[model samples]
Target: MPVSSPQIINMGCRLNLAEGESIRALLAGRDTIVINSCAVTNEAVKQTRQAIRRARREKPDAELVVTGCAAQIDPASFAAMPEVNRVIGNAEKLKSEAWEAYDAVLVQDIMAVRETAPHLAASFSTHARAFVEVQNGCDHRCTFCAIPYGRGNSRSVPAGAVIDRVAALAANHGEVVLTGVDLTSYGPDLPGSPSLGQLVERILHHVPQLRRLRLSSLDGVEIDDRLFALLTQEPRLQPHVHLSLQAGDDMVLKRMKRRHGRAESVALVERLRAARPEIAIGADLIAGFPTEDEAMFANTRALIDDCDIVHAHIFPYSPRAGTPAARMPQVEPAIVKARAARLREAAAARRSRWLQSLIGSAQQVLVERPGDRGHAGNFAEVRVPPSETGEIVTVTIKAVQEGKLIA
Candidate 1:
């Protein structure tokens, strides 16, 4: 439904951001668009709610829609709000009869394991970077995660469809990042058991102009020799990988039912480094789970320090209501906070070390937004001499300042 005024909002992750942009295109005829959502932590939930209130104040009678994971998981709370006209879960609001009532609509559909082909064409991103969701849903039921329950099973759109979308995105001067609930799980139900490597090869071959093709999080256990070899051959593939390492302690990993533990995870990172020395590796770490004590937390810190990780996402364990970890003995908030502080310090140190390594090295940077001073890239911030916002520039790192590289 096109309205003289319309706003769409999203919460959480790059994958969710991509879907929100798609929804914006679907409702493009609307004169105004506002996205009010994100759900990384409880704090993000507060930020999203405030964004919704602000949007209501700005566009009093504008059509409004609230979707994505946060809205899908908790529609009733959103529906009770005075500003929300309708709340649909997943993408179900697109099919709602009540959509006619307001100039805008909100949909909350049950997260499905699979996705039907999108009816709308791919969005031409105005930003230098665009994210393409190659897969959705998770088959692994991690004890601490509510993701499998929120987003059904693993499913993938056809490889051809993904390439077509990338082509369109590339035409608009954007680098494409393949994202999903678990990107390594892509192509499970698709024809011929197409591998993630095959998908990367196809996209690189077809869309040669694509500035960069980055992969989202992948499972360390699933990293095979074939995939590693493909990375060496495909120069377009980004040298960065964000492996999901929820816990480094074996007992904690077993409780979480993660497929891999510290030893194997460490090996995978080593393999990647051996194959590509310049690779930037990152991982996700959880602190203070039900099974995590000071010893377990220490083990995690040691593993991260030894793993040669370029960066880390440190999160305190939040017990989602229905997860197995929630039913287990919960950690004290005080303990979680302390562990998180330690991990944050470690992560910052590693990030600074990685930035230092980039000094005097030339890197291809896809310029994002123009900052007050200059532009930001994957590695560091640069003050381009008379920098233009959208252009991709090659620059040599002149120095390492604080935690970022200066060019």
Candidate 2:
């Protein structure tokens, strides 16, 4: 990749965005620039094409090398695009390269891990919080996902090394979030010395002045009594959990090849609530899978209502290339969009109810950004009298005002 005025572009989820930050740090202030690509859905792919066209229009002959899961899953398709000069995939771009090429090398040597030498938090995004990738890759075979194809088997960075990274971020007074493809499977490759829970405990014990510790999306299948107990014991850890529940209908769960079913997932939620009633639960819901019809959608809606989730990252089903669901007859685009809209509406209602319930209670709120003369917590954005940034203060929930709780 080569250009007179080069800039990096990233597309996809937080994980991909995190990787893009790492890549930018790898090639910061250089004449050459790297572009992180995405393959989340068909619409996303189209958006990527439009973005590439726009990038070319902005900077013709820019050193635009595309990487990430999108490039990994379908390199030739991306290679065919006119905007892309080079496509690297399958851990090939993990290494430092002076020259550009279309390459896909499946490298899984944790020992050969590409450290940007001085690992730094993403500079582009808001600095209120930072997420560090402690684990990479997946072992589960979800029918609709392209992640396993892009990322190989589970592997974790050494615990001491991870602590060092967290310490670096803490020194800058940034909140640290432990993230991964499947965080539950963290520390599997290494000899069973310390688990993800152990890592958190170590960080909490050592870094006493750390602002906050958060965890990424956790799988329900991995949750047990011990983990829930540990969560109750830790006061510094945020009470938000982003559990990915693809479907609430059992048959749909089978079709999606998800590990946990409706009943078990519900049980897990109940246990969490029992342990910590104030714990804010977050969830992901995918609507309009191949087997999902009106009744199935109703079941999903009811389940969401039952779960009483405060925040939802809802997505419509879209098949990616080389995945099992891609071969199956996809739900019509119109249906997918409609169900997705309904789910969003339901999620909004749930959040409103949760916020209403929080009124007349006190919460230890961390002032992230100065909003329209207010502040927000790990849960809802609460309006406050003028306060300094990074000020962690307690506020009594007064009422739900304009989609935010007033304190």
Candidate 3:
């Protein structure tokens, strides 16, 4: 019988998606199954458990292993599951030896990991674009976040390693997106304290063949002046800025232990628009948090318009175990769901208007596998004429259909 190749089931953020590709390369030819789990929210953990059981039922004969943030934080619980044969930590998952002859449970103290494993840099996701894990972990202790404990402290992959990886990947892919747990918190842990902007500068400067570069979610407060200049002036960098703006009200932000408030987020968007009008704004907003009154939710709802957010990731408050938000006065579950729906409606309207605005303009879109669809530099989804896959083409927008721009 022909041996089946190993499979990697990814769950969670783009960082995990990127790491999953790396893990795939590592476990090549092995007849095992790996579930890259997430633990950002209570819902995420529950979903991870569901994925474990589902994977087990699909491939009952294969050895099932679990890894990623969920497994890193609580390995014993996953290992005890009847479906799982092995459990590994986030750090160990990247190393080659861990997969050779895995132990029943190999989770370690994540907080003690100071250096990023350099070998996991070059990973492939798609022919059109590639996601690179430039940074990992989080040092911030936001009241609602359990990710810090799961991912450990902030650590950066050195500039040289990252640039080398990008150069190699750029030879094939048209776009490269930098991803991390706390992306904006990059470089502080590195020698000479190279800022994320400096790293971008180096990547763009060195790898001239790279067509486009994009950044994952960022904390607005952490963006330095150098990064600001790049966002406003650099044409190679994609024109979409997705901020980690959790709340819009001052009191709510303070309660959540977030660094920036509503005004700061609005002002940052204003400044970005002033510098580059075509730049699209994206943000992550929690609908209802602990002690969030109707007025506070109103402020958050207004942020959709105030920030001109064209891309929004609206998450309802789901308290995770061991998080400070879980201990705080909780908002009613029904209220949280209602507010989340309102935020989504507001965001959809904003995005619809933004897409409509592009109806008359011409945009350079990078065609993906389907050849008829791709995203512009501003991250606007566009329906284009048939073109070569992985090739960049110019399209004249004629109208807006549903959520995509027709060309």
Candidate 4:
């Protein structure tokens, strides 16, 4: 295949975006169409297929390549697709040599790989802010999750390498978001087994020019004391924290094999708020889990008010094959969809109330692009006058319209 400009269609978490950037950098000026797929849910898999078809239709001459969790889990399924010419695994996708010698499907068992290398991207093509991958994979086996099978074991990039990458990005990018499969599970694989907080401290110490540092989704139970202290002391660290609180009910959490309970999650939120009064909190909540009754669902609904979760990513339970939850007593599809909608409604109300509170407050908005739409330190969407794409500017909240802060 003649080397031409590569087109990458990335779907899924911040970590995927970060990996896609690296893949883009590796396949620069190549005539390849890479569809980075996600298998987080059945819908995600369907979306990946849709994206592949769309990519093929748009660029008929381009060579289609598939990779990421979806492809990693089911390589043969993607390979059988007529639109796809090649399928690669999660680990293989990061290697330059894999792309260099890309002729056939090359996917290996992810579990066999023990170490994670820091795959640094020259720049990000999708967003203004740069996401640096600090860790990869998961060690925990949540009953509902099939991610560990695709992503393999938890592994961390050495803290020094991470600091270097952050420093490099700090030179050009105002904000650097640290991303990973299991972000809070970082550093357990390293030699000293330094904590995520230690890595944050190193980045702060080394990269003084970096304006803001943000974190991707974190497991509440994995948060160390050092990180909690930083939450209180560090102003450069973004005030918003998105926790991976899958369920709010204690029994449901136990069924999910999650580490944190309802009380623990609530206490963590309260502690974070006490440390930083203006801090905004977000969470990932599942609407209908296996064996969840009306009372259990009500606990999840009440958690929105209890935790003050203004921003939420609510997912209705979808049983993935090979997971323990797939064999459990299932919630009806209609009930799941309805519960998801209700959860979304509740989240919107909480978000509206939070935005209303911020109506008269001054905010520092990081301009994502020229249209004056950007995100505040607390991850609230803000609209202001036109500014430089990557510049951070101060704006006063004038009103809330259409669920966004207007300045």
Ranking by TM-score: 4, 3, 1, 2
lDDT of 1: 0.71
Q: Of the candidates shown, which would achieve the greatest TM-score relative to the real structure?
A: 4
TM-score of each: 0.90, 0.87, 0.97, 0.98
Candidate 1 scores a C-alpha RMSD against the true structure in Å of 3.1
Write candidate 1's Cα lDDT for 64-160 as tens digits: 5665566666667877788766554554433324334453334434444257336323673546677788887788888888765556678787999
Q: For model 4, name the residue pairs that clash.
A: 4-29, 4-31
Quantify all predictions' global Cα lDDT against the true fold. 0.71, 0.72, 0.90, 0.91
lDDT against true structure, model 2: 0.72
Model 2 agreement with the true structure over 223-282: per-residue lDDT tens digits: 655566666557778787778887789888998899888998888888887887767778
Candidate 4 residue 40 C-alpha distance from true site, Å: 0.5
Which has the higher lDDT value, candidate number 2 or candidate number 4? 4
Q: Point out where model 3 deviates above 4 Å.
A: 1-3, 121-125
Report the alpha-carbon TM-score of model 4 versus the true structure: 0.98
- On lDDT, the stronger of 1 and 2 is 2
Minimal lDDT window, size 10, model 1: 371-380
Sort every candidate by lDDT, greatest first: 4, 3, 2, 1
Q: How do the residues 68-172 of candidate 3 rate in per-residue lDDT, one tens digit apiece?
A: 999988898998999999998998898899888648999889999998846554657455888889999999899999898878999999999888889999888
Error (Å) of candidate 3 at residue 312 is 0.4
Query: Which digits, one per residue and each the tens of the lDDT, describe model 4 over residues 158-194?
Result: 9888888888888778799999989999986788889
